[model samples]
Target: MIFNRVSYGFAAAAAGAFLFFAPAAQAMTKIERVVSPGGIEAWLVREPSVPLIAMEFSFKGGANQDPVGKPGVAYMAAASLDEGAGDLDAKAFQARAERNAVELSFRASRDEVRGSLKVLSDRKAEGFDLLRLALTKPRFDQEPVERIRAQMLTALKRETTSPNEIGSRLWWRTAFPNHPYSLPTNGTLESVPTIVRDDLTGFVSRTLARDNLKVGVVGDIDAKTLGTVLDQVFGALPAKSDLRAVPQARPEAVGKRLEVQLDVPQTVVAFGGSGIPRKDPDFIPAFIVNHILGGGSFSSRLYNEVREKRGLAYSVYSYLLPLDAAALFMGGTQTRADKANEAVGLIEEEIKRLAENGPTEDELEKSKSYLKGSYALNFDTSTKIAGQLVQLQVDDLGIDYWERRNGLIEAVTLDDVKRVARRLLNGGVLFTVVGRTQTAASAKQGG
Candidate 1:
């Protein structure tokens, strides 16, 4: 009986046929506001589910706000919070959280830092107090800080020699030169050593302003009570300067090729061109195109060509990283050293073919259908919905974005998709190879 929920696949199949046939349904869900006495603002959705409460605290200026030479300050600070807080030691705090069945975590992305908390209804006060301590009174204990820093440093040192990491970092640096977005979210070795306690403190103080905080609470909680809880957690944060201003991203050099030789059996190749920014009028169409290209998993062009037909790589995929200023379209595959070049060639050929002759009607319909039909599955939980809402807010999407999102996907026409593919995929494509060099003898021997 539970298997009946698996209707998304069929719904997706019907998406293409009904694109223009059905009228848009009423989509807006009225967001309940939670306004605290301290002037904190939050969107509260009260669902009396299983006696639990989940809240998301989102602050602007995530990894992008990391100071130059300190690339991972945001991540480092986020990681340090759980290590120690208030008077409790790191292990003690963790044990306490587990004992109380509370889930509190911090994560940092390019443009936002999120602190999430989930707890039982009865222990909401205590759970929230612990979260507040982590947010506003983290100790940055020397012992735990050093241990975590050493762990991260060791990882960075190891990743430097990894072919996958080498190719990925190279792509970002080449694709986004002179932009904060170009910096690695994980701090480099040189930068990690310089991150003192004061650096973490200063970053938290400046970036965690009340004005910059957006709270979303869901589950068994009233708007009034949730507003009070928000104040308890975020009211102590000092009012500081707006840290939301992101630096303008420089234009990416498309169609560029880069190669790195590492002693390995397989070569890793990453290639693609620029893509539409989040605010582009063609964003929906471009999204559809991306899904058709590789974002649709087994049903995509790259997978069909590279994996199924030529067997060039075990897996190949493409995706669109649509940001505020610009978008980066990237894809990659790993193959045997000798076959690496051939695989890259095939990928390039496919890119050119898509440019020269746009997607077929069938392909376009399948892509649009998949894009619209599968979106509902992404919001199965309140936590996920809150996260999506935060991103929509950061992108300046309207309040009714979630309601109208499916309609926009349906509006993307075949021509619209073709136009975006031509316009956005013009950057100098980078060809990065990370593997052992094939000797002349090996080349001649076809080994």
Candidate 2:
């Protein structure tokens, strides 16, 4: 999933969890790239100030590795990872973790299967043991599998009536057509049920291997100790993952407006189009531009134009969504059913306006300042810091990326913003709305 959220809460297609955490305060954080004797590497931040340690790691392939008919195999596998392991049953395993104060979970996102662990420094041995077993010796017992699948089935059922889910998934299906990108990260209603134990085990063996792993740890653990922990927990996995090649894709059906008419009171709107990938030279500038356009909260052009001035919707937002396979410029809003067309029209107008003229000098400077100033807040906690390091590794940003991040923001020149604005927004966005709207007959958007 893209760290920048897709509005309607479904942009990453919501297979599972993706948590965004910023690096710790620049002065306090020193990231250590620790490599184990067994050749495992982890980014570590030793914060003895807290007795708790937090670690996060991920394997490269997520739902992208699911078999053709089973979209949620990765998701179900991840959710079931800790259900039992080695000699432990589900109840015993969970109880042991609780007694030792270990917090652990696994989740599948669009691009990776992720795991997080937190434990008291005194309980490190027990926590690491549990994690190791979960990774290399997961049981995937039948009872637990049925339980987790049932839970997921219930959630999918709820999404049937959720306008947000309907609109978000519809937009994705429209955007990518036949590619894997079009499928929900969590499989469709029909595919999940057929995922048996063999499928879950296949996903693990094919994707969760040492070569594709990235790890980050924060709090209490020193580099030498962490090196040992890394080897112990990860050393036993297969040396290489058998990840299949997934093609790079671009959003299709640009400038088109599609709808699903449900009898909801307010309309759910999701819109997006082509975007710059994370590694693109212009991405940082695009990020700042997006902030000024819609991410600046109450002061953004989108919020000010659509909500504060015209009162068409209660909230409106846009973000840059750079995924492993594709990138997107996305946004969402909800408004009274009667006002859906006007709200969408106003959104398009603002997009066109921004792409045509670019942001004002004031908007540019303030957004830069806000973005730089608020960054360290994301890493205030040990869990957040740990998660962030893992994410940075996934993005392949340098070990020193955090130190240089604010400077990059400062360097986004007016010309840079203007160029990226036209480059990104001029193409227009695809709109997928759910609800009965007053202007159902309105011409298709992105035309």
On lDDT, the leading prediction is 2
Q: Pick the candidate with the highest TM-score.
A: 2
Q: Per-prediction TM-score, please?
A: 0.87, 0.93
Clash pairs, model 2 backbone: 255-445, 255-446
Count of residue pairs whose backbone atoms collide, per candidate: 10, 2
Q: Per-residue lDDT for 1-447 in model 2, tens only?
A: 211101222213222222332334653458898999999999988877556677889899998889986888888899889889999988888888877767788889878999988777888899899999999999999999998888778878888888888888888878988787787887777988899999999999999999999998887788999989888999999999999998999898888888777788889999999989988999999998899889888989999989999898989999999999998999999998888889999989999999999988999999999999988777766677778898899898889998889999998899999999999899878998888866553322211
What's the CA error at residue 132 for candidate 2, in Å? 0.5
CA shift at 132, candidate 1, in angstroms? 1.0
How well does model 1 score by local distance difference test?
A: 0.73
- Candidate 1 ranges with C-alpha deviation above 4 Å: 1-30, 242-245, 437-447
For residues 1-447, what per-residue lDDT tens digits would candidate 1 score against the true structure? Answer: 000111232224334331222112221155576789989887765666346666777888788888767887888888888776898988887777766667777877787777877666777887788888888889889988887788778888888788888877777777778777777787788888888898888778878888778777666788888878878988898876457467566446566566777777788888756777888788788777777777888998888988999888888888887665556787888998888777877878877777767778899888878777777665556666556656666677766777778888878787887777776554446666667645321111000
- How does each model score on lDDT? 0.73, 0.84
